[model samples]
Target: MYRILIVDDEPMIRKGLQKLVEQSELPIESLRTAENGVVALQRIKEERPDFVFTDIRMPKMDGLELCQHVAEMDADIQVVVISGYGDFEYAQKCVSYGVKEYLLKPVSVKGFKGVLEKLIRTKSKVSSESFIAVTLLEQWASRMEQAVWMLQDAELDLVLDEIQEELKTKHFKLNRVVDMLAEINTLLEQRLNARDVYVMQRDFDLAGAENEEAVWACFTAAIHGYLEELKAKRKGKLKDPVEEAKLYIESHLAEEVSLEEVADHIGLNPSYFSQLFKQSTQETFVQYRTRRRMEKAKKLLQQPQWRITDISGEVGYADHPHFTKTFKKYEGCLPSEYRQQMGIRA
Candidate 1:
């Protein structure tokens, strides 16, 4: 369906023209009517109509003046003028403005038919690519909310499926694109859930340049809240050994973290502590500690003052190469690359 703009000062004339355009065989699905040339220019820029029709003697601006301005603005549009007179001199001036067709009113049925017939043959072919771009925009909007939901559910495969379903009307090749984004979101989620690192970054962004203290304060509040929620859910309280062992590991995240040390801290056997931690967090104690440390490593990388080796040591990894490999295991990209992205955005 081609876009058509009606530029006439008279309300009745504009409405009649719009209705006629929409009723035409060429499928004028997006027809808009503007009261004057000023309004017509605004509509032209916004909707970018392929075809325009205007009366000759509108108040504040006339048809020939509008034609010249439209050419100066975007010469691609097709302009047809409607005049209440059969004046040759006015037509001569309009020709210089690139006015394709001039009609003498009252607009006979035969005249509108000719104008639309020509538009179907010329304007439709010119706007096909733009129409496809618009359809793709429509598809993205249609998928955005649902895609976000699928990601939050940890359903990465479901996200791609939803994108394919959403673009069924447009038949867009969105499956691979959405799949890649889902993978990124999964990594981001892992980091977010690990010691609340992503939440800290989000807080920093929201708190602004002068509010570093405020960001930290918010993070502290969220941590207290998460702890309180755990206390409230007595029925699903974490495995027995985790009650003390996990707390020990969190405080000692910058050291050579050991399950045996954590078990000794909590007065539990090391093997029992390991199994209990997995039952509580759905991850082995070592994997959980590594993930949490990598999350901190990413946050440390955000600061300009920290070196990668220093951050790696600070996050409890005794071996720098080992830290790099594990960070890559969870974050897809290397720590340095992630830091580069943070700096670029900053």
Candidate 2:
């Protein structure tokens, strides 16, 4: 849905156009009227309407002036001039200011529909492109978050470089790029906050930046500073990675444990963490986690009040049959069979 603002000095003309637009039914979410260009421009700034229908002659500011302002302010706004005059001079002037459509005097339904359909087509195309950019930004931001937690400076730089290249090649609008950068900043800030990292003061105004380069620089600089802080903290207080992984696994026995997550939690490379874990414990990380989970499952299974399916989930297995199979393999008996041997039933 789109919002439209109708600007005209005459009240009757405003109502007539509003009625016509409502009758046309072109996906307009809102229909607003302004008595003159000044009021219309204010509404345009505040509302950021998708379409602005304005008359050429008006008090305080005319349609020509409004067209120029809209062009300077935001080219995304579709400005349509509705005037009683058939002057070529007026049409040329509007064209100079990037007015999309000029409807002379009374607007015919057919002519109005043609202009509206064209504008909607253009807006849809832009919207689809913006969607792709947003999706890519989100995916990259998630990867960047993981890299930050894992203290992988190379991975972080690689993700940011890919994002920068994508923005340049795609030629996304500066505002859209700013919005994407803001989203990345928010994600990183939340992740940092979760780990009790102090977020640096943000002095840069992303939206007010002069150009895309400046915006990208601001984002990358902030991320670099944040990464440096993480590095400093890691160096100042190094913990045993294997011990941390063990603690993490113990807490998350009821959840699916992954080596990568454990490595990230301990700020070590996943492969290095896996090797260190094996060296330290004489067992692979997966083997240790499975043993811990089975130990926990054994205790839970011993309780006669606990159901077998519930016991399965209590130790991270969501599939009851798979849990039973694994339990039989490890204990040489199914969970129910083990319970029966212990003089229990479910």
Candidate 3:
């Protein structure tokens, strides 16, 4: 189902389009009417519709001006300009402003339906590909947390490279790409908080980021500087025992390692180690172990040949349903959904 906004100065044409949409079998969720482009823009800002149908010559603001505004605000909205036969030449000029289709005045049932079907098909395909791109970026964010924690500069560079490539391949708009990078930064900051490493939000001058490369340059420079500060902080610490516990837990991610076992391995009393662990790292032993297992499971899910059951067992989950539930809680999606988004077949 989709929502549509009809913009026209003529009351008759607006009523006609509304009636046709109501009489049609297409899945239209709602319909809104606006007399001019100014009103249409107000409606769009209030709640964006999937499609906007506007007449070319309206008072105050016309369809062409409306198309330009929509393009600047959201690249996803499908704009169809309706014009009289005499205005057809004028409507053709709207293509440069990202108009999806130019419809002739007195819109016919056949022509309107064809346009509707075409737009829906295009939107569906983009939606699926966008889902996959977002999932990949999220996985990259998880890997980034590890790289920063271990102070691995090479791995950080590689992760950023992978992120930039994914964004470019998807051909995302500059604003959307910036939002994605901000999301990754938020995730990184949250994970770093557990270790008492608080980083100030970088003041990104994105006004100059008119292209994908420029955006990437801004993001990488800020992140690299943040990592340098993290390194300096690590150098000030003396012999962190928690690092040993983390190493052991990461190495035996497939096994259920108990806190007492880890404490004995690190030559500390279990009680003392438990308190020290919580003081040094804000997370408890079980919480840390679960987070690592879930992150490991996400990485394994990328491989299509690996069965979901085997991946669960590999991450120390003996029960399949439990693994699915835990994964859903951690990633906000099922293991199968995650794999599908990563381009893995069932």
Candidate 4:
């Protein structure tokens, strides 16, 4: 539901607009009114409405002045100016301020309805929920990003699971969450060195409330703080144990990386190492390793230069059929189809 603020000097006009908005059956969370620009500006700071509907002429501050104040505070809120004078000049000014529309005086119910319909048709702009969610996802992704340069199977899946749950709960917007995660990962990689890069993917998860927006913001902040902390500890170099394991995997991508081998390499018993891997990597060790292998397979198949057998060997798959099956499961397409779709040909 979008909150709307009506800023009109006339009591009757304010009441009329309020009534029309209510009658439209739009998702109106709140309908607030301000008699003048001063009062409107004060309300503007206190409340984040989705739109502001104002009269062109008024004492103290006119519609134009009120708009300027609101615009300075937040330009995203749709502004609809009410003008009884039908003055083209005033309408033009409103347009210049990025007003949604200029409504003529004695705003006819039909005309009001038409404009309202147009507004409803327009895509929704950013909302408070999104702003908060984006912030949290960014944090979570960034923390993982700092801990592992390459995403791992265990923890990455867990994070995705949590996000899916958030979406199911209707706490977060799916697209926004994914976008924020992508952005944070990209940003983290650009800022960190190889050590930090390799460490990030294994080290982050959602630590905030499951509420979509809150979770997103908290996750984002956690990563930011962790990165700063890592930088401080390593004298600007990445020193995470997770980074050590990831670098090992990169160097041995073509080699078999069993859970036992990875755990043993990190000096932990097999089961304990698996647990550590899940805690850090966010997925089971086997799952993460399989993803890493499939990812390489996908990249290799995209080249006209690499054969299925060669790519399979490179990704530590002894059998071509197994590689093909895994790639299909993870990427939702067979390697051949994926390559063709990407415009790659042998």
Best by TM-score: 2
Candidate models: Cα lDDT each? 0.62, 0.77, 0.79, 0.66
Candidate closer to the true structure by TM-score (higher is better), 1 or 2: 2
Q: If the candidates were sorted by their TM-score against the true structure, best first, what order would they fall in?
A: 2, 3, 4, 1
Q: By lDDT, who's the top model here?
A: 3
Tens-place lDDT digits, model 3, residues 1-346: 8889999999998999998778677888889999999999878655567888899999999888898888876446888888999999989989988886878867899888888888888877876776435566668877887887787878988998887777778776555576678777776667667666565344544433545665676677666645655664656635566898899999998887899899778655454466557656898888889999999999889988899999999999888899999999999999999999999974
Candidate 3: which pairs clash? none
The regions of model 2 sitting more than 4 angstroms off are 29-33, 86-88, 125-135, 147-162, 178-346
Ranking, lDDT, top scorer first? 3, 2, 4, 1
Q: In candidate 4, what residue range of length 10 has the lowest lDDT sum?
A: 202-211
lDDT tens digits, residue span 1-346, model 2: 8888999999999998888888788888888999988898777655567788888888899888888887876436788888776654675688877786878777888888788888889888987864545566668867887887787889988998888887777676655667677787776677677766655433334644555666676777667656655664758856665777889999999999799898788776564455557757999888899899999988987888888888899899998899889888889988888888889985
Tens digit per residue, CA lDDT, model 4, 159-217: 64565566556443433454355466555555555554334332434321323554454
Provide C-alpha RMSD values for all models, in order: 18.5, 19.4, 20.5, 16.4
Which residue ranges in model 3 land beyond 4 Å of their true spot?
Answer: 128-130, 133-169, 174-346
- The TM-score between candidate 2 and the true structure equals 0.48
TM-score of 3: 0.43
Residues 129-156, candidate 1: write the lDDT tens digits: 3323444433433343233323332232
